[model samples]
Target: MKSRISRLASVMFIGAVLAGCSTFGNTFYTASYTSVSDAGYVIPAIPTEKIPPQYRRQIVNYATNEAPGTIIVDTKSKFLYFIMPGGKAMRYGIGVGREGFEWSGTARIAMKREWPTWTPPAAMIRRQPELAKYRNGMSPGLKNPLGARALYLFNKGGDTGYRIHGTPEWWSIGKAMSSGCIRMMNHDIIDLYERAEQGAKVIVQQ
Candidate 1:
C-alpha cells in the first residue's frame, strides 16, 4: 500500500508541473497592462478581456528594410508596427479609413499633442451638419474623437490633414471605420505617443 501511494503522489506531482507550465506559456501571448494616467482624466489600463484577442498589442517578428523607429501601417491587416531593432516590432491593432476613404503613402510625424483639442474640418462639417456645433473645435476630453494623444502627419507638400490619433472607441480596432486617419485605442496611443519621435517616418501600406 505504501508503494502504491508513493506512485500516485508522483503522478499527481507531474500533472501539477505540466499544468503550471501551460499557464506560464499562455502569459507570453496574453496582453500585459500597466497603469496610465494622462491629463485630468485617468485613462484606465486596458483589460485584455475588453479587447479582441487579435487586436491586443504584442511584440512580433517583422521583416522590413526601414530602420528601427519607423512606423509601418499595414492597413490590409489593420495593424501598425513600430519597428524595433533585431527583427522585432511593437504591433498594435488599428482602425483605418473605410471604403473610398482609404489612402496610402509615406509621411513624417510633424507634431504630437497630448489631450489634443479636435476641430472638425469644414468639409467634414458640411457632410454632417450636426457636427457644426464642434466646427470651431472640441475641448480636450474623453468625448473628443482624438482621445488622449494625436500625431500630426506631414509630407513634402506640408500638412496632409491626416492624423494618427487615439480614440475612446477601443472596440473599433482591427476594423476599417475612420474617415482617413489611423485610430488607436486610447491606452495604446498613449504608449505609442511616448515612444514615437516627432519626426518619425510613417509608411501606410494598403
Candidate 2:
C-alpha cells in the first residue's frame, strides 16, 4: 500500500509539470499573434506556427553600448533589436533589403504614421513601371506594402527615404527580400510602434 501511494504522487507531479508547460506554449503564441482592430481596419491573426521560433517576437538578454530605446537592425541575421533598460531587448524577426538594394547607416525616426500612404520613389517607378499608377500615392489598406504603421528614418541630410515599417507578408520575416526598407510582421510592428518614439536612434548593420 505504501509503494502504490508513492508512485501515484510521483505521477501526479509529472502530470502537473507537463500541463504547465503546455499552457505556457499556448499562451505565448496566442497572445502575440491575436487579431486586432485598429483605425477601422481588422488586422488578421497571424499563423505564427508557420514561422521559425527564432523569428518570432521575444525578449532577450542583449549587450550593447547604445542607449535604451535605440533600434538596431542586423540585416545578415535578419533580426531587429529594440534596446530596453536593464541590458535586455525586445527582438523581432525582420525582412531586409536584397543584394544591391541593401544599405547601412545611422538615422533617427523623424516621423511616424498609422496606415501610411505609400508613394513609390521616381526611381522605383522607373524600375517597376507598373507602380507609376501610384505616382501620387497609394491609399492605406491591407494590400498596401507599408502595412499598418511606418517609422520614417532621417539623418542630418534629411529623409533617408528608408522606413522601418510593417508588412502584410508575415512570411517575409526572417528573409532578405525588400526594396531597402526594413519590414516587420504587422503584429510585431504594432507592438514596436507603441514602444518606439519619434527621434529614436536607428542603427542598420550588415
Candidate 3:
C-alpha cells in the first residue's frame, strides 16, 4: 500500500510540472485576434456592448466543401465565414451592400493595405458631386472610409473596385448599407488582414 501511495505522489508531481510548462508556454502565444485598431494612435475596440449580441463575432460549426482559409460572404445572412480545419469556422458579422449595389461572384484578394485611402469613384462623384473633392483619393486616417485595414478584391477582368474593409461605423454591421463593399468592425478587419493572404479566395454570395 505504501509503495502504491508513493507512486501516485510521483505521478501527481509529474502532472503538475507538465501543466506548469503548458501554462508558461501559453503566455507567449499571442492572440491572433484583438479589438485594438491597427493604426492611428491605438483606437479602442468597437463598443461591442452597444452592438447587438447576434452580430458579435463567434466560432461556429460550419459545414462546407470549400477548403480551409477560403472566405465566404453570405449576403442574405449577413455573415462572413473564415473556413477552418474541421467542420468549423470563425464567423463574423458583416455589413453588405444595399439592394441595388449588391455583388456576387468569386474574386481573389489582390492586395492589402493598412489604413488605406478612399477615393470616391467617378460614378459616385457623379451622383454626389460634393464628393468630387475626394476623386483624387482621400488620405488614410481615422476619418477615412476604409477604416484601419482593407483587402482589395480582384477578378479575371481586373480590380473589382470592391473590398473587404474596416468601418468605423461598427453599428452598421449585420446591416445592408454600403455601396457594394463588405465592411467589418475596425477591430475585426485588422485580425482578418493578418490571416488573409494576397491571393486568398473570396466568394460573395447573393
Candidate 4:
C-alpha cells in the first residue's frame, strides 16, 4: 500500500508540472501581416469615425455567457461574445446579415485558416456579377475579403459559407451590411482568431 501511494503521487506531480509549464508558454499572438507602407488599415485609431459614435456604449460593457471556448453572437445587439471563465467575457462589434439574408442557429467550427483565400458564393456572384471574375481564388493580400483569418461554421456536413472574417469596410462595423457573412474590423478579427479553436461551439442568436 505504501509503495502504491508513492507511485500515484509521483505521477500526479508530473502531470501538474506539465500543465503549469504549458500555461507559461504563449499559445497565440498577432502576426505582423503586412509591411509598413502597403497596409491600408485605419480602423482602430478612430472607432467613432469608422463606426457610428452612438454604439460606443454597447462596445464597453460587453457581457456574455460564453465560456472560454464558446462563441455567442447576438445579431440583434450587434455584439459577438467570446465567453471567458469566471463570469467574464471578451466582446467584439460585428456587422450581421443584410436585409434579406439574416439567419440564426447553432454550429460548430469546422475549420480555421489564417489569411484564407476568398471565394465569393454563387448567390453573391448573382447579386453582383462583377465578382464572377475572381471565382478561381483571391490570394491573401490587403484587398482579399477574408483579411487575416476565417472561422468556417458548419451544421452537420454542409458548409454555411457564413464566415466570421475581416473586412476592408470597417465603416459598416455595427450595421447590417453583408449578404450573410459576419464582418469584423481586421484587428478585431485577428483578435478573435487567436481565441477560436477548430471545434469550438458557435451560437448565433437572432
Candidate 5:
C-alpha cells in the first residue's frame, strides 16, 4: 500500500509537468471512516478520515485552464475542484443551492471571514418566521449557518450577496440546499478556506 501511494505521488508530480495538455479520469476509493489501512491509493488527508462515507468520492479528471487560484463549482455533480499546478486538482464534495437557490456563471471571492456572523435576508425571515430573530445578526459558531468560514462572492464591480461558505451539515452534500451560496461540509470548508485565496475567481457550472 505504501508503494502505491508513492507511485501515485510520483504520477501527481508528473501530471504537474505535463499540465497544459493533460487528460483526466476518476476512480472511486470509498471505505468507512474507520478503515484505511488496506486502501491502496489514499491521499491521507484529514477529510478522508473524518468525513462521512458518502462524501468521500472525488472527481479526478476534470481539466481547467483557470489559474491556481480559481474555484470551479459544479452544481449538478456537487463537486468543487480547486486547480493545482501540473494540471492536477484537489476536489471536494459540496452542497449547493436548493432548486430555487441555484446560480451559475463567473464570480470572484470578494471577501473572506472566519466564523462569519449570519443574518437572514428579509425573504428568508418571511419564509421562515423562526429566522426573524436573526434578522439583526446571528453569532458565528457551530450553530450558525455559515459554519466555520466564508468566501464572499462578487462580480466585476459588486457583491452578488451570494457566497461559498461552510456548513455543519455534512449530509447535505450533493443536495441543492442553501440560499444560493455554495456550501461545503465543515471539515471540507475549513480545508478549502485555508487553501483558497481572497479574490480567487469562481465559476459555478450548472
Candidate 6:
C-alpha cells in the first residue's frame, strides 16, 4: 500500500509540472481565451476545445513584405494577421462575409470604440425587418452583435461601412456568416483593439 501511494504522488507531481510548463509556454492562449470583465460587462470564457487549433490566436512566423502594424485579412483562410517586425505576425481567427456579401479592398482603421453601439444599416433592416428596431442603434451589452470592441474601416472616399469588430457569436469564428464586416471573438478583439493603432492600414484579401 505504501509503495502504491508513493507511485501515485510521483505521477501527480509529474502532471503538475507538465501543466505548469504548458501554462508558461502558451501564456497567449491561457490569457486570451479566459473570461474578462470590461466596461461594466462580463465577457464569458470561450470553450477552447470547441474551437479548432488552427483558428486559435497565436504568434507565427509570417513572411510578408508589408510593414509591421499592417492588418491583413485572408478571408479565404478566415485568418486575420497583424504583421509584426522581423517576419512575424499575431494571427487571429475571424468570421467573414457570406457568398454574395464578400468584399476585398484596402482601408484604414478610422475609429475604435469599446462596448460600441450597433446600428443596423438601412439595407440590413430592409432584408431583416425584425432588425428595424435597432436601426436607430442597439445599446451595448452582452447580447450586442459588436461584442467588446470595434475598429471602423475607412478610405479616402470615406467610411467603407465595414468593420473589424468583436462578436458575441464566438462559434462563428473560422466561418463565413457575416454581412461583409470581419468578426472576431470578443476576447481576441479586445487584445487586437489594444494593439491596433488608429489610421493603420488594412488589407482584405479574397
Least accurate 10 contiguous residues by lDDT in model 6: 22-31
Worst 10 residues of 3 by lDDT: 22-31
Name model 6 segments beyond 4 Å from true: 1-31
Candidate 5 per-residue lDDT, tens place, 102-148, comes to 78989988798988899888898999999998999999777788877
Q: How big is the RMSD of model 4?
A: 9.6
Counting only residues 3 or more apart in sequence or on different chains, how many pairs clash (N, Cα, C under 3 Å) in candidate 2?
A: 0
Better of 3 and 6 by TM-score: 6
Q: Largest TM-score belongs to which candidate?
A: 6
Q: In candidate 1, where is summed lDDT lowest over 10 consecutive residues?
A: 21-30
Separately for all candidates shown, the number of backbone clashes (residues 3 or more apart, or on different chains) is 0, 0, 0, 2, 2, 0
True-vs-predicted CA distance for residue 144, candidate 3, Å? 0.6
Q: Global lDDT of each model?
A: 0.86, 0.90, 0.82, 0.72, 0.74, 0.90
lDDT by residue (27-96, candidate 6, tens digit) is 4332257688898889998887888777788777899899899999999999999999999898899999
Candidate 1, residues 41-153, lDDT tens digits: the string is 97766666767666777777899899999999999999999999999888889999999889999999999999999998898998899999997799998889999999999
lDDT of 3 by residue, 1-206 (tens): 99999999999998875552322222321122234534444655556457655566666789999988999999999999889899987777899999899999999999999999899898899989999989899998777889889999999999999999988788889899999999998777876887788899999999
Question: What's the TM-score of every candidate structure?
Answer: 0.83, 0.85, 0.81, 0.72, 0.74, 0.86
Off by over 4 Å in 5: 1-54, 57-59
User: Model 2: how far is 138 from its true place, Å?
Assistant: 0.3
C-alpha lDDT (0 to 100) for residue 115 of candidate 1: 95
In model 5, how large is the Cα lDDT of residue 191? 66
lDDT of 4 by residue, 1-206 (tens): 99999999999998875552322133211122232232343333334433443332121233555557788888998888777776656667789899998999989889888778998888778989999987887787767777767899998868887899887676777899887788887766776888888889999999
Task: Output the TM-score of candidate 5.
Answer: 0.74
The alpha-carbon lDDT assigned to residue 172 of candidate 4 equals: 78
